[model samples]
Target: MCAHYESPRDKALLKKHFAINLPSELAKRDVWPGYQSTFIRRHENADVGDDAVPPREALLGSFGLIPHWSKDDKIARHTYNARSETVAEKPSFRDAWQRAQHCIIPAQAIFEPDWRSGKAVPTRITLANGEPMGLAGLWARWRSPAGETVHSFTMLTINADEHPFMRNFHKPQDEKRSVVILPPDLYDDWLQAGPGESGVFLRAWAADELQAL
Candidate 1:
């Protein structure tokens, strides 16, 4: 499954999506797939802009995780998402899951697909009013052999809520569900304020905060 996110504003276009901007000294300026994002450390880089120096939080590193153990460097492409279900135990994501939480790439809306007749149709999911949206994600910093630092991010997926409108996208709902839909109520908490698996938070979003078309 793939994800599509839009800008922080309420528009159907793709260019306006909010991507994390890095400081000029941030080292690597590489862009990500779909031209979607380049993640930065929230505590270290969140509030600072490129021109703004001495950012309150130091520039820790960029997203695209660099497993503290890998000596090869290309592992990032495969180590993106740390599945919420198995994150606590996975070697790649486990370390950051409970301690080094990173911010995710957010959007006003994201798209999924409905496959039928051996073809795929895209469906856009967003808030009825069109506010910014967030996906579950993990981040990492990779230091190039040259020592330049780059950041990267990954989108998390759980079983889709598959409202009557979006069900055509995947498979039988009773089987294995996969896609994580975040709701408005859980937005703040998931991003900066809650605790636990947050079932209450997950249910709220799964209920009605989304509209897929």
Candidate 2:
């Protein structure tokens, strides 16, 4: 259920790959981490993923999720999409899923599904060598009463089998499937270890990094 993704990628394709700088700080964002660009998450607390580092921070939230003893915001219109197997048991994401983690939603493509007969054709996925990839994130920080605070993010999914290129677009999921991509070297271990080895180093990466079109 990736929905749609493609973080723009200008500034010379993130300065020809990492070592970026030019995301001043929120100013009407979301052209896919826009407002300045260069977006990536996972580090609600840290536990691996190269310790989840560099040129990845463009928070301007609102992909659903506004928990913190919520009093409004209608359950974030459905709380975006969080299901890394129930995000540790979601109650607005169990303490940000064990102190929150898993990020990097930079991109090149993402739309999802060819579900076929029941409709939903769409399909996009990417990086079978097309480069650019990152997804699986969760971020939060809400406050406002006099001390404004608003940082939000969410994007994590699984279930999409056999990828010769995102398997003709995630065809499995009638139940028990796979989707979501990342692992070009743990993308920073998930945030940088700690939290009991960052969920076993993000379930161990190595899906050959990616090639899912």
Candidate 3:
């Protein structure tokens, strides 16, 4: 479910790779669902017309998704991940997906549980080349009861039963699944993709690209 991850890279690296400023508060070693983290998305500026390019910006948002119609924040705990197969139809993610509110979550590594030992053991997974990677996500904007706007996001996941590496985690009896980690070249395309075309990029990442630590 990708409940936790590390984003310890420096701001300079984030800017160099994603071309956006990293918020000071998000410059931390670890990020968890329901916590404020950095995400990259396109935003329309008032001065720019619809025909102009929407500026790509890195902004702070909670890791779990909060639908625009959500009455409270309690639902966030279970909406941190949206299954790719059902994301377009799921109540929690349907609106964001239909509206094309896509985003990229930059991270150095992700933590998961290894159940081979009979007891769950925490394991860290990172790129085989030790580089940062981007997880495909959906973002939402909700108006709080206090009239403040709250932004949140959720990672997109897919069945990974056939994956060589990803299938090793989680409970043995549970369906194996993994989050979609986009390649560097697809970052811009994913962020700009329409709802109909977004499915093309939701497959599992190559097993060779990851290393368990």
Candidate 4:
């Protein structure tokens, strides 16, 4: 699970890459579960008609996902990552997947542990080209008893036991896995994807395009 990652602080790069204007300045940090972060997705308001232009927007949201029907926020700690193989069948992610509530979680880098030395050594991973990585995710909106609305999301991950670079992380005895990082060209497609077409983008990213520090 990718529990920590560095959110990009360069607003210019975010505008240039995602083509959306941010409502406020975002601070840079090694984001963890329960932390507020930025994400890009199509506007959910019905007022924004389907035929209207410029349907996508960037918004601030919590890192962990909370299903609309969840009784409390504690479930978020375990819902931060939804396994690709069972996302559509899992109770926490099934509704979001079925409704096509897709999103892109931009990151400057992601932190992982290297256990080769018999002890965990922290390492940061980023794109070899130095561009921001857009991780595939699913967003949800939960209404609290007090009528407050909470927005949260979960990163989608797939088994990577055979991947050259991703397979290097995690315990040697545990199943290797990696988050789905979408290419630049696929950002819009992913956000607008239907339930039937979303599965096509859930594969492992190219290893040669990434660098681990």
Q: What is the C-alpha lDDT profile of model 1 across 60-127, one tens digit per residue? A: 23234555565745665565444556666777766666564545455556665556645566666677
lDDT of 3 by residue, 37-81 (tens): 888887646237764554577778888999989998777888989
Q: How do the candidates rank by TM-score, highest first?
A: 4, 3, 1, 2
Top candidate when judged by TM-score against the true structure: 4
Question: How far out, in Å, is residue 211 in model 4?
Answer: 0.5
Which regions in candidate 4 have their CA more than 4 angstroms from the true location?
25-28, 45-53
Per-residue lDDT value at 127 in model 2: 62
Q: Ranking under lDDT, best-scoring first?
A: 4, 3, 2, 1
Per-candidate clashes come to 14, 24, 0, 0
- Model 1: what TM-score? 0.62
Pairs clashing within candidate 4: none
Error of 1 at 22 (Å): 8.3
- Indicate the residue-level lDDT of 112 in model 4: 81
TM-score versus the correct structure, for each prediction: 0.62, 0.30, 0.93, 0.94
- Across 1-213, the per-residue lDDT of candidate 4 in tens digits comes to 799999998889989988877858584577888888898898766246666556678888789899999887778778889999999999999999999999999999998887878888888999999999999999999987788898889999999999999988888898988999998898888998999999999988889999998
Off by over 4 Å in 1: 7-41, 45-66, 71-73, 161-167, 171-188, 191-204
> In model 2, what lDDT does residue 161 have?
47
